[model samples]
Target chain A: MFDTVNLEDARRVIAAAEKKAAAIGQPMNIAVADAGGNLVAHVRMDGAWLGSIDISIKKAYTSRAFDIATKDLATHSQSGNQFFGIHASNNGKIMIFAGGIPLKRDGRVVGAIGVSGGSGEQDHAVAEAGAAAL
Target chain B: MFDTVNLEDARRVIAAAEKKAAAIGQPMNIAVADAGGNLVAHVRMDGAWLGSIDISIKKAYTSRAFDIATKDLATHSQSGNQFFGIHASNNGKIMIFAGGIPLKRDGRVVGAIGVSGGSGEQDHAVAEAGAAAL
Candidate 1:
């Protein structure tokens, strides 16, 4: 009843994210969730920060929930914006920072990828790589 | 990152659940999450109940969150019990019912498995099969 990322694509996304993290010399926690915000894939690098594990998963959930990259959401979540309190609304699972990107299939979002354990720019870059794997 | 359930193990858990589900002639939605309550893997078998997708994931999260099986938690969630109304907490993600089981290694909880789209007893049995794959 719903368009979702298949298992094969989910693993491909994770592999791309892992490659980017290694290229950047930063370990990362990566997560992928279907359009329904259901987890499809996950990975924690050998040296990634443990705390970033949940953040990565939550970022993917938030991206799939909103159909937008978290960096864009970060702008709208700033003070006095339409979604100002959005992060605090979803049981503190909304990730307004960078590192979350929705995956598109024929111009429609089918899933999202999230990466953490680095600067916002680095995280976003890795997430972008994951999305590019589509 | 800390030692967590790898992606391979997460897939193995799902396959085990699928095998049990098939043997029983019932489809299922299975979920696996690491000890931190972060999602690791999820699969919704053909003809499975859509509603059970979220339930499966939440059951896994609840199991990992408390390090106890949902079957055991159900007892504590009974009326007048210590954890009554526990389902209303954590954004209503708690599944104080059967089908959730924690995955252990060296006697420490490392992750959890959950199965839905079946009776509580059936779900519990499927979840146990998934956990045994570890």
Candidate 2:
């Protein structure tokens, strides 16, 4: 059976992401999803952008559902690109942008973390911190 | 200006709900929403049903959007009732069932709490515990 993230793993990832957000002086909404792209946990930091809550959760689903970082997906999802309009799929749950990273174990994707409430670079950085924790 | 639930408040509510769920020996997915129907936080307890995640969040939104317990809403939303088919509205966000309750402060609804993963009665009980904390 494939290993998947659990509540403890999700909390660890979120804690790391929160640290990175604090280091950068940016509050964020962070979400973790298991191998099935189902959310395990989520948090919207105090004063974080309210709109990012859904985006963070959807981003984690997008990453684990596709096993690719959302930053890479954004490239192909641009206009005239291979994945153009793909965001319209999954009932608008696909988020093609930076900030989502798949967590790996034994070189296999086990889960994903998504961060929002900052620029693409900052979000990606925070997600990287979270993924590293896993 | 009307008060709205924040991340801190959301955490407190979730903690109370979690305690109640533990006492009942039922893990659950819990969600809290701000007055604007925006999600503040969510958590899926270990071993909770995956499908309950979305249901919990939507239940919170539905509760805040209508300022009524979903148990009561279900009564009015049944076939041939005044609100029959109301679930078809809100882009599938409305959950016409138990477990969603408005969070009120000084006689005004400030937010809502939702719980899923158990029977309707259990879910409603957990939500009530969360709302009581807020």
Candidate 3:
């Protein structure tokens, strides 16, 4: 198995996401997961929606579990797609939506970040910033 | 809803659980969930079983959702019990196993902790240490 995410990397990702969230004027719940789809770090900004906490973590979990961005999962999980109703599986942990991206190191998936408490486009932008920090 | 769990508390709980796990010579995957059954924090220690990561998080979620210990849930979900086959429901997120316990404050469930990567008794012991931190 590949090396899992460490605390430092997870913190860096969250910090980048937090900066982006602040720049975009949105409070965010950010989550990072290791290659094994286990959470490594998380941050819920004050005034962020409580409901977004789980959504963010599950999105990060989903991204790391599949080694794919959640946006890709969204297409695959759509009606008549190969992974239809995939969200209903995995105890609703599979989030087929935007705002989740995997972090790659030397062409290998090292971890992932998921952002919530903003529009999908905003969340995706912030998550991309986090991934860029990897 | 009441106030959600703070990040400091989650970290403290994990630290306590880690100490207990190390005392027993078992690396562990520890997870904490807020009262709404959402993951707040998680850690998979070095050399911990990868399969236990998701199980630990689900155990925490199940405990918070039901406001009871997973061991109690295990008993209630046994053959001829009222919650028989409960594990198959909730998209298989219900972990009717030991090592999951709620964090209660003033008799109200605030959050939960779950530990894995050892015997059920050992896991339970570690999780108890986590809950005691609350």
| TM-score of each model, in listed order | 0.74, 0.94, 0.75
Q: lDDT ranking from best to worst? A: 2, 1, 3
The candidate scoring highest on DockQ is 2
Best by TM-score: 2
In the order shown, the candidates' Cα RMSDs to the true structure are: 3.9, 1.6, 4.2
Off by over 4 Å in 2: A79-85
Q: What is the TM-score of chain B alone in each candidate?
A: 0.97, 0.98, 0.96
Among these predictions, the greatest lDDT belongs to 2
Model 1 iRMS (Å) reads 4.0
Using TM-score as the measure, name the better of candidate 1 and candidate 2: 2
TM-score of 1: 0.74
TM-score of chain A of each: 0.97, 0.99, 0.96
Candidate 3 residue lDDT tens string, B1-134: 69667767788899999989989899998988877777777777777887888889899989988988998999999999999998998887889999999998888888899888898999999999999988
* Stretch of 10 with least lDDT, candidate 3 chain B: B1-10
Worst 10-residue lDDT window for candidate 1 chain A reads A38-47
Per-residue lDDT of B49-120 in model 1, one digit per residue for the tens?
A: 768877998999999999999999999999999999999999888999999999998889999998889999
lDDT of 2 by residue, B1-134 (tens): 77998888999999999999999999999999999999889999999998999999999999999999999999999998999999999999999999999999899999999899999999999999999998
Better of 1 and 2 by lDDT: 2
Tell me the tens digit of each residue's lDDT in model 1 across A25-80.
99898888887787665677766887897899899999999999999999999999
